[model samples]
Target: MSLHPRRTGWRFQWVTILWLTAVWVLLWGDVSWGNVVNGALLGVLVTTGLRMTPVDFHGRVHPAALAVLLGRFALDLVRASFEVSLVALRPRYTPRGAVICVQLRSHSDLYLTLTAELVSLVPGSIIVEAHRLTGRLYVHVLDVETSGGIEKARQNVLDQEARVLRALGSDAELAEAGLSRSRRAREVAAR
Candidate 1:
């Protein structure tokens, strides 16, 4: 079955709508009902007005892993914020910047995009470019020291991808990425 079926009447895509609405709310930096309603309206308008590519997805949600992903994300946000602030405040230190390409384990565009977005949200790093076919993301780090090291930075992106896949990928999808339904598997995949 297709991820989204072709409908003749309403042609509504609920997943796309929710994704777009979430983006809209995040962009607005608010979680109010007004923002939600407006975002949903805009989401509907965009989906109806333009053509969208169908994303392939047949995965079950892992609530425990999903919760871990979100909780780690919040902690990372705060930590990155503080570290970036320190770098900015230090007048004697010169930041070493580098653009590194990270090859992701998952070939799916969905995981690649999710990892890129999540990585970009944290301070000191931005996604420079993403190759859809290659599953590689070119990321610019404001300071190598601030973000540990080049290798660590690359691992960080991969770890983020692992978190995303563990949260939303099915057993088959996980196995495809060399991940299994075990703590050891998650640990190994994150590295």
Candidate 2:
């Protein structure tokens, strides 16, 4: 099934309305007629604010995939927290800080942003820059135990990308293209 859809202004309006109402209910915890009107107005203002900001391509995504991706991210965050904490507590540790380049397969800006944000939130790594033209991410890591440290970090990013691609229902070509590009970039950098 084709997930992509042509979104209209009305759709955006409805989305904004629904989102605002939900937020209001959550915040106030009591829904009354007054709250309903206020929430709707707030939604409109929020939508207007959003409209003023320019965003890149907004693509339709598979719901199942998105759910899976979110779940995986949650799990990864928990695991990363533990790992980072352990690394931090070790007083006699020699941290090998290195900037690793990660190649992303999916061209979606949302996916890229999500990946970057998620990785950066983790303790040991931070995404310093993302090259739009190359779809490559430069990540600064807190620890590196040799030259392979960069490669390991790159692999972690690639793994996250793979999960995102799967969630988006991307084909093998797209996945392979991203991995190939990343590998090639790393090879060139190494040489």
Candidate 3:
């Protein structure tokens, strides 16, 4: 099934409307009825008048996979926080960091953007730059002691991608993303 379906009748972009309304309220520093009405109108106008080509998406949402991904993220978040704290607390601690490149499997702009944002949000690493055409991300990692560290970082990116795909991608997307046979097998085992 297609991700963005055509509207039949008076169907509108409710998500866009809500997002614009939220932004408007934040910008105005108030949440009045007038502000909401204006924001809704603005959203309608922008979405309809300034129309951009809709993104083509074919991924399916798997709730179980999403739950697992969220659980892993929470654990990683805590672990990273501690690791960063340890580095910060140490005296004369110089960060052993390097810019590591990770190539993404999926070419979807949505996946690329979400993955970059999610990776950057995690402590100890940040996306320095992303190549739109190549779907590659140069991430600045906190530690890269040796070749092994680079491999670890690369594997971490792959793992993150796999989890994200499982959470939000269809089986076809999973294959398209080129996840390892072992990882792919695990998904079946999970079901």
For model 1, what is the C-alpha lDDT against the true structure? 0.89
Clashing pairs in 2: 96-144
TM-score of each: 0.79, 0.68, 0.77
Q: Tell me how far the alpha carbon of residue 53 in candidate 1 is from the true structure, in angstroms, after superposition.
A: 0.3
Which candidate has the top score in TM-score?
A: 1
- Poorly placed runs, candidate 3 (over 4 Å): 1-12, 22-35, 49-53, 145-148, 180-191
lDDT score of residue 66 within candidate 1: 94
In order, what lDDT does every prediction score?
A: 0.89, 0.70, 0.78
**Global Cα RMSD, each model:** 4.2, 7.4, 4.3
lDDT of 1 by residue, 52-105 (tens): 666666687899999999999999999999999999999899999999999998
lDDT of 2 by residue, 1-191 (tens): 22222333566568758988888977998888888889988887776655343334334465776787789788877876877777778899877688878878766666688778878886678999988677888999877753246777788888777666555534453445443224465587579
lDDT of 3 at 187: 84
Per-residue lDDT value at 85 in model 2: 78
Of 2 and 3, the candidate ahead on TM-score is 3
lDDT of 3 by residue, 146-191 (tens): 3249888887777787788888887788777765334669688679
